[model samples]
Target: MAFQWQVDPEDLFVERYPQMVGTGLPAADVDEVRAAITDMWPDRSGGWVHEWSRLAGRYAAAGSPWRAALAYGWAKFPALADTPKRTALSRQVDQYLLAAPDFDVAFDRIIVDAPYGGGHVAVPVHVLTPPGWSAADPVLLASGGVDSWKMDLHGWFTELALRTGMRVLAFDIPGTGETSMPLSADRGFDVVRALIDHARTLGGGRVAHLGISMGGYFSARSGLAGEVDAAIVLGGPVERSFDPDRTWAYGMRGIVGNALGFDTEPTDTELAQRMSAFTLRQWLDQDRNAPMLVLNGADDVHIPQADTLVFKGRPETEVLLIPGTGHCAVSKFPEALRIMIDWLVASARW
Candidate 1:
C-alpha cells in the first residue's frame, strides 16, 4: 500500500516533539532533525529520509552503531514504502544490537501470544527490568499510539521503569509497530489480556498498563476488564471520539483509520461503527474494574475532553484533566510522568 500523508507532512514534522522528543536525542538535535525532514506524499521527496540515512551512515562510520541504528529508526518513523521501511528497520536492529553492550540496562526483545482474527498473533515487546529486579517485581506494559511506535517510546519507558522500580514491557498497539495484526476494536482487549497472561509468567505478580494516545484505549479496556491491576490512560478517547455527531479535524479520522488497518480511509459512518466497538461506557457496570487513572489535555483536538470524564463514577478511578494542555500532554511530560509513577507505586501496594 502506498503510504498516505495523514496531514501536511511539514506540519506533522514540525509538530514532532509532542511525539518524538524523548527518542534518545538531544533537544536541539530533535528540532534540527525534524526541521530537516521536508517530504510530502504522492512523490515523498525523501530529503528527510536522506538526511537521517546520512546521519546513520556517519554514526556507523564513527563506530557508534547504536546511534546509527537510532538514526535509521528515526528515518522509518510514521511509515514508508515496504522495501525502504523494512531496510531501515533492519538497519535499526543491527545498530541497536551492535550498541547494546554500551548501554546501562540490557533489553530483552520477546514475542508473546495474542488473539487476532480467529486464531492468535505474536506481539513483540521490549523488556527491561530494574537492577536486582526479580521475576517477582511488578510488570508494567507501556505503549503508544498509531503513529508513535514502540521504538520511539523506549527511552520514556525505560525511565518510567527505572523511576517506579517496575519491570517494563513496552510494545505498540495492534495497528502499529511489530504487532502488525489486523485491527479490530472489539478484539483489541484480547491482546491486553494475553499480555497480562504473559506478564504473570515473568513473576506472577501485579501488572499495570500505561498507554498514550490510541494505546490508552487498550489500557482503559484492560482496567475495566480487571485484566490489569492498574491502568493509566493518557489522552484516550472513549465516547466522544466515536460519536457520530463529532467530526474529527486535523486528519484525526485518518490517523484512526490507519490504526484500524483500513485499506482506504473509511467513511464517517464506517469509522463510527468501528470506533463504537471500542466504547468503554458500555462496559462500566462496576464489575471487574481495577484502579484507573485517566489523564488528558483540556485543549486536545483529537480526543473529546468529555471522554476523560467517563470514569467519574467508577470506584478507585481518578481523572486529571489538565487545562490548556494539548493531546498526550507532551509539553508537561515530566509532570505527567511523575503523576503516573506515583500512582503506579501506590497501586502496586494495593
Candidate 2:
C-alpha cells in the first residue's frame, strides 16, 4: 500500500508553490501549473505529475532545460512512491544534466560507494568547484531533506561556491533522491561519514557540512561526532521530534513515512519506535562537537523551536531563530544564506 496524503492536494500545492518558485522555477510557469493540477495524485488526468510533466515538456521544447528540470522536479514532489513520481524523478535528472553544461561553475556528477548494511551502496554526488578553487581548498558537503533533493539545490550550491570560494559537494541523503540506501537511523550516518571522508581527500583535509531540513539531522550527527570541521543545520530537528508522545504536524507523517522506507503508513507507536534511533540527545549531553551553527524560523511549525534552542549552551555552537518566517526560514532565505556562508567562511577559515 502506498502512503496516502492526509492533506488536500490543492492546499498542498498552494502551500508549496512559493518554495517551488524560490528554488528557481519561474513564477509564471508555476502559476500555470497551479491552474492545471486539479488532483494531487498521478492517477488523475489533471493530476500533479501530469500537469507538471506537461509543463516540463513545453520547457524542454523551448530549450529551457533548467525550467524543464524544475517542472519535472515538481512533478515528483514530496515523495517517490508511485510509478509516475518515479518516472518524473528520472526526467528531472535528465533535464538537470541538460542544464549542467550551461551552469556558471564547473560541475561534475560522480558516483561513489558508501558503506551500508555491511555492503557498499553507490551514492551519486554533484560536485561544484569555483573558478579559482584548488585541490587544497576547503570543501563543503551540502544536502537537502526528503523532498528537496540535490538537483533542487543547484542554485544554492553554485552560489555557495561563487560567494565562499569553497568547492561544494551536494548529494541526497539516505532514502532520498539518488541515494541507493533506504532511510535507517542506525546506518544513515554511514553515508555522512563516507561523504566527509571523501571531502577530506578533495580539500586541505578540512571539511564542513551544510544540511537543510531533515538533512540537518545528519549535520548535527556529524558535528556531534566531531567528524567535520564545522556543521550547519537549518530547520533540522535534533531532539524531541522523535518523542513517542509528540504528534507529527502539517500532514508530514505520510511524506516522512515514505522517506523512512515504509510502503504502508505505520501506526504512531511503530513510527515512534523507528524514530527513536534518530535522536542526538545522548551525544548532546557529551561535551564534544565541531564548531556548529544551528538555525530555524521562529515560526516553524514542522519542527519545535526547542530543537534549535537546545544548542544554545553548547560549546562552539551558535543558534539563530529568524523572526516571522517558517520552516528553514524560507521567507527570509536570502538572509539565512548570507549568515550561513559568512559563518562557514569564518569557522572553517575557508
Candidate 3:
C-alpha cells in the first residue's frame, strides 16, 4: 500500500491487529519501562531529554488532530481528562514495551556500568543466571521503550528467561532506562560495547543481541562495532514506513527535544519525514549474515512484512508467519512461545 492507502481520509492509518488488541509487554518489563519513563529527572541527568513525549503529544493534537481518536483505542486517561497541558501519551507505544519476564522467582541484580569517569551514565542490569547455565549464553539488551512496545517484548523474554532456564541479561540504556546517554549513534554504540564488557565480568560469553522493532536499529549498530556474537531480530523493521508529518508519536518527541541537534523543534510533518532516516539497509551493509530470526504477523499493518523480507544469511536465517497476530502478539500467544522457544533452543546457534 502507498503512504496514503485508503479513500476515507478518516485519519486512522491502520486498524489495531486483533490478536494484539489487548496484548502488552511482560509484567516485569512493564514495571521497568514505567519506572524509566516516569523517573525523569530534569537536568539531574544532563544528556537526557525530559518531557519530549509531552511536546510530541501537544504537537500531535495541534497538527494531526486525528491521532487522539486513534490513540484512544489503547488506554483511558481516567484522572487527567480535563488537564489541558498534559501530553496525550497513554497511547504512546513506549508506555507498554518495557514491562516483562516476571522473575516470579527472584534473581541477582548487578551493575552494568563502568566505575571510571569516562562513563557518562550508570546502567544497572538484571542478571538471571540459572544453575547449570552455560557461560556462552545469549544476552538480550532488553530494550523497554516505544519502538518495541508493539514487538514481542514479553513472550520472547519470558519463556526464555523462565522455562529454558537460560542465562539471560536484561539491561536498559539511556533514553531508555537508568543510563541517559545522548542519542548520537557513536554514544549509543559505546553503551552497547560497555554492556558487553559488563556482561563479560559476569561470565557471559558468545552474547547474542535480540533486536525487536525499533530495537533492531541499535542492535545492528552494536553488531557493526563487533560487540555481539550474533543477532536476532524478531518482527524487525528493515525499512521505515514514511511519516507524512505528525504520522508517528515519537517523531513529535524528537521534534520537541530538538534531537536532530537543531535549536528549535521541527515541524510535526518534518519530524515524520526524518523518522525513516535509519534503515536496515544501512545496518546490514556489512552483511555479516549473523544468525537472525525474523517473524511477522501476516496481518501486521503498522510494519509491513516486506521490510524484513530479505537477508544474505542462508541456513541461519528463519522466518515464521503466525496466522492471527501482529508484531508482539505472536510472543504473547500461548502456542507462539512453543514455536519460538523450540526454534531458539533447537538451533543452538548462539
Assess candidate 1 and give its lDDT: 0.75
Clashing pairs in 1: none
Put down candidate 2 lDDT per residue, 172-240, tens digits, no spaces: 989888884677776989878998999899889899899999999999988888889889999998898
Candidate 1 — worst ten consecutive residues by lDDT sum?
Answer: 39-48
User: What do the candidate models score in CA lDDT, each in turn?
Assistant: 0.75, 0.86, 0.45
In candidate 3, clashing pairs total 12
TM-score of each: 0.89, 0.96, 0.59
What tens digits encode model 3's per-residue C-alpha lDDT throughout 1-350? 00111121111112323222334313442233233333222312220122323323453556532232223212211111112212333343232222223333235556665432364567666666555666665544555333222122333465566666566666543333234343334555567677766666555556666555455555645554456756555555555443343233312253223333333445556555555454546655664555656665655555566655654354466666667766644434566556556655754665
User: Across residues 1-350, which tens digit of lDDT does each residue of candidate 1 receive?
Assistant: 32354566566654565555556655666666666666633324346566677778888999988668777876766553345665677787778778766655667889898877689888888888777677777888889887676676667787887887788888878777677765567777778678888887776588889989988988888888888888889998766776777777655566667667777767778877777777777666555588899998777878888889878877888898887778888767778888888888884434
Where does the lowest 10-residue lDDT sum fall in candidate 3?
A: 1-10
Alpha-carbon lDDT of model 3 = 0.45
**Worst window of 10 by summed lDDT in candidate 2:** 1-10
